[model samples]
Target: MATPRPFSRFEFLIAWRYLRARRAEGGVSVMTWISLIGIALGVMALIATLAVRAGFRAEFVDTILGANAHTTVYMAPQRIENEFTDDVYVVPGRFSDYEEIAARLAEVPGVTRTAAVVKGQVMASANDASNVAEVFGISRADLEAMPRIVDPATSYGELDRFDEGIAIGAGIARELGVGVGDRIRLIAPEGARTAFGVTPRVNAYEVTYVFSAGRYDIDRTRIYMPLAEAQSYFNREGVVDEIEVFVTDPERVDEWSFPLLAVAGEGAQVWNWRDASGSFLAALDMEDDVMFVILSVLVLIASMNITSGLIMLVKNKGRDIGILRTMGLTEGSVLRVFFLCGAFTGIIGTLAGVFLGVLLALNVENIMAALNALTGGGAWQPEVRGIYRLPAELRAYDILRAVGLSLALSFIVTIFPARRAARMNPVEALRYE
Candidate 1:
């Protein structure tokens, strides 16, 4: 027996004929056009929404991770120290153990770098102007490990000029009307209440570096100082408030966190970036869920259009069905023909949408800028949104999922119509036509 050729020219011809017929009627029927449009629109919406969501996630995550370390170790709230009791839950002095733990953690696989950090809420005053800001103390050497604050060419003359220098947020700088080389006074609440009154000590330092993290909170109220200065000013010695850790694999922070915590022993606790920004992360997750659910409805509606269009096509092609059935085509083959037709519509629409979506995602920044220009909104900078530009990371999994969903919907929509066409009696269909 001769081997059957794998590619069936007949099936290809049949499919092509149907497709050409769809194009030649000056376009398909109103219903078919509606289905095609529906599919196109559905796909476009899915791609665009997912792309935007991805952009938002990346922007926010980068901003946060850049502003802080990938993970932090702090005294458990229950174990806060007496000195920091007023403003922060101070943990008992564990500086020695902290250093030891940090050393061990640094040895851990995937752990990049760890540094001691001190943080406090303080009132910053320059001359007569005062503003409340969160002050973070970090080692000057560690600052290099952090994301660059300002352009390398821009000298932080203010930060570099003094030994006990400070870096303030751009917003804070603007509010103070003070720049680098200006002296500022910092007041922190001490745990001790003086005999005369509650005395909050004030320490004066010069503003040195100004950083803009592009986050409203950070850019507005954050200040950075040398860890030693912070420890001295905050009256914390042989004890640091937190240990910030940078990790090589941020996504798998938990993998290193648990083991490192064990090495750090009972006094210290670990927090990943997600834990530090739980509320924001939750909001992002919720937004993604809501957007996906909402956009998926559009695909569902498009699927309905597929159903309606296929049903109509089945009715209109009754005579053709009858002839095909009479010509010895099996019911299964007949069903496959209609299924292929519906599947083709979905596949074409999905491909077109994917192309358009990727193109838009890649150039969303340009598109936004163009729109902003058209609207005369120079203030609509991408940086204002905390992202320099839209970031579209097209994942193969996402594309595969989308294509699979569309094809499944199309197949489901084709079922009843295909079944009806397949079951149509040759005599009845022929007689009716």
Candidate 2:
């Protein structure tokens, strides 16, 4: 008698029938279903986690880069070696000629825009309400160039008249119960020197523009004033605190840092956005890595179900195995048949999981809305998270990683049961029958 090819049509036929067999016929139909569902759920969960993590990173970086300068060149004190004594000495500094410095920096390659900014903290009060806010004094042309502040959907009022007064965040508008054309008093603790020491500077300005930056902290605690007005309010005439640099590619600002400093000249310091937010970005990256490890373990645990199911399947088909062995079925054929059973479960489950996970990622926002309605609100808080909605981005590499992990786990766990079935003794298997 001749042996058929390995994993021949007959072996698959036998495996298929066994999978479909009734429980009364000593089949492991229930275990098969259980294993399939487990792997599918595990894969789905892993994919979902990756999608949300990627989305979160994208959103966070966008928020940081959107509202901030790629880099900032500051007028700071620098140590210079004294020629006679060989001693290092420090001197006070300020960008009195900020326009010239900004122009110099703008001449560098990839530098898109430059603006001199005055920054301070002050108290804002209107309509019986008061709050502390961080103020940035910038020119109207530069403010108009800010995509987030000049957005039509979330901002209103006049950009043309921005030089005349102030542009306040929407959150400030709500807190003070004020609107466009309302007057708000700003009080600075460090004010002009007088005969009786120093007095706080108090001045009121009309709200010329109302803007919503879509970030909780910025919208709540930020104010924008015209550059000259800010300079006067801050008591810093003919000078700015720092010059903000906007680059074509913010992510690659490190490449331009040296050149920026070179053009900025002596006693100047260049600080990029990444340097300012490095700790925050590092924390996010670490969390994402941890989540991937945790979710991958979940997929591994779910794959363990395949081992138990296949073992039960091997035990149940002992009598059939004995008869097949006696009729000249080889050990390799038996192994292939049983291995194919688990492989089928793995492939199908992985496909199903990919489908469900992609679907979940695509509809996550809608689902979040539905959950919020069902729970009567409080599902997500933009104030706490600094984001208005949950974002999910399904990446192809992430999906492939999940599928590869699930299938690899399935194939590995199926080996022992398949081997056991292949090595079974025909005489012992038939003895109880």
Candidate 3:
């Protein structure tokens, strides 16, 4: 008996012939073009949406991590001069046990660096300017851990001026019309004075440095001082508000936090940056989920066009399909042929969209610049919400997700038309023609 021919080049040729014949016979109809365009647009939307969300999430997280330590151990409220405390609320005080706490926390697997932090809200004034600012007290030795607050290269002048001095955010400096070598007054909250009729007290300091942390909140409202000076100013000598720890792996923050809290005892509370910015983080996640759903719907709409295009192909190729089946083509091969045709449309459209998406992502900054220039630079202002330029961060996972979803939807759309072709009776199809 003759050996059955291997389903190799010959099978591919049959598939190719079927594909080409379908195309030649009204396959590039209005419906086909619409399907191609829909798929392209869907892919583009998915890429752009995902890129923007990814960029926003990454940048926002970096900003939070950079501005604050990975974990903070603060004096528990009840322990803050003996007041009732809540799990999330820490009473502000000078933590005398900071060194011990730091040593213990440092022993934790992921701890990298630990430092004392003294934080308090203060009203700052220089000349006729005044603004509410958060004062961060940091040790000179531990300054390296707070790189976001001070860039060594641009901030040497500021760092050198730190003796009994303070670094104000650049925005605060601009608002106050003061820079290095300027003086500013600071007012802190003192205990209620029953004897003095609840009077308030204020302190003064010199603004010896100015730095920009690139975040509006930090640059506009944060100030830093030498740890000792801050302690003295707040009248809490040899004490600190909390111990801030930097971890090698940010993902393990909670893993280290619980143990640190246990070691810190009830006197202190351990907090990660996630707690500090929980609302902002939740909003970011919600926005990303919403955008993904919206973009996926766009892709689904695009797949509908694929369905229409395939149905048109099936109708146009009725006679050819009948002839092929009469020539001994199996129903499975008929299905495979149409499926290949639909898949080709999806592949080409997806590739084109990917090319365009990647191009746009790479040049997004430039494109924003051009638009800003065209709009007289108003669009580049930070006064508006979010950052100045449109940020696009394309990740392999996001690309894979978009491609997989698009292709899967395309395949689903091909099924009905493919089955229709497969189920056609050769005699009936030929008799109709």
Candidate 4:
């Protein structure tokens, strides 16, 4: 006597035969194709969306951490009493002890480097064109410490003779049609005190270096001069406006803030990059979540097609199922066969989608290049978002999420139609045939 077992070879053979059956023979070949295509498209969309989102996030963060400081220390608000008048007065705080403060802050466990910086707003002119620029008076040593600006591949010109001249951004060079060794004039509104009146001070300097920060705004407006020159031009002779600090890990910037404040002493304020870019980061996260939900719905809709297709398959094969039941085939065996049909479509569609999505994500830059070549101009502009292009980066977590969600939906939807086919009475199924 032979004992029956579940998911036997006979069950799979029946399922394979029904899957290959022609429409004229009451097969669900057409529905299977439709369901497979829908799921493939849905999964492809999810993978592509996630890859692009991760790319955007990484680019933004890199530009922030590489080109700018992780945290900045500024003079805190101060209030003083007027002894002569017995009236309270507010005096602007200046960091005369900036060097001492910088030394103490550098000792903080996570701190990597610190630089005293003087900033001033002035009108920059060259080639008879003028634009507003934010001038930073930084020492040559500090300027070279910046990874993005000092890199030879990304930046143009030499910083060795930085003290004698100025370093301007690549965007500024393009705006004013100036280049290395080109003459650019900076006009300060508050000039030397004269007996008659105050006049704007106009000074000329040769552009010794030009750098790209990979950010449109930073590259457009930043000009670096020697600390001494900036102090003289801005009439801030001895003190720096603030001290910019870099750290080992920018993500833990908040944790370092308290330690920084302790060393910075009284009348000092510390602000991290997050404080400056919080709103934009929050909006990006919200947009990512919304897109995921919308695309997941698309995937869910695609998986539902599996249910519809399997139901039609069960109805069409009713007579065959009735005959098999009379031939001593159990209901469980019938259910397994129908389940296999739906599972085949889901599994194959998912695998195809993964392959297609990965291809698109990895070759996104190549695709953009092809588009630009065809158009004889850039197909995508970086002006709006301030980066090179829309890059895609695939993460293992995201890929796994897509695969798990798709398979789960596919298996859950396949069960109902499969169970219905198994529960049908042989008499009723044969009567309909």
* TM-score for all models, in order of appearance: 0.82, 0.91, 0.86, 0.93
Indicate whether candidate 3 or candidate 4 has the larger lDDT: 4
Cα lDDT computed for each candidate against the true fold: 0.73, 0.87, 0.76, 0.87
| Worst ten in a row by lDDT for model 4 | 19-28
Clashes of 2: 0
Candidate 2 vs candidate 3: the TM-score winner is 2
Q: What digit string (tens of lDDT, one per residue) describes model 2 on residues 1-433?
A: 6879888898888888777868585447777888888888888888988898888778777766777788999968767899999999985466998999899999999999999999989999998899899999999988888888888898899878888889998888999998888899999997788999889999999999998876778888889999999999988889899999999988888998889889988878889989988898899889888988898888788778888888988888899899999988899999999998888888888999998999899888899899889888689777888866788999999999899999999999889999999999999999978
- Which scores higher on lDDT, 1 or 4? 4
Q: How many residue pairs clash in each candidate?
A: 5, 0, 3, 0
TM-score of 3: 0.86
Q: State the lDDT at 250 in candidate 3.
A: 81
Q: Which stretches of candidate 4 lie over 4 Å from their true place?
A: 1-6, 23-27, 79-92, 195-198, 372-379
What is candidate 2's TM-score against the reference?
A: 0.91
lDDT of 4 by residue, 206-232 (tens): 999999988888889999999999989
Pick by TM-score: which candidate is best? 4
Ranking by TM-score: 4, 2, 3, 1
Q: Is candidate 2 or candidate 3 better by lDDT?
A: 2
Deviation in angstroms for 72 in model 1?
Answer: 2.6
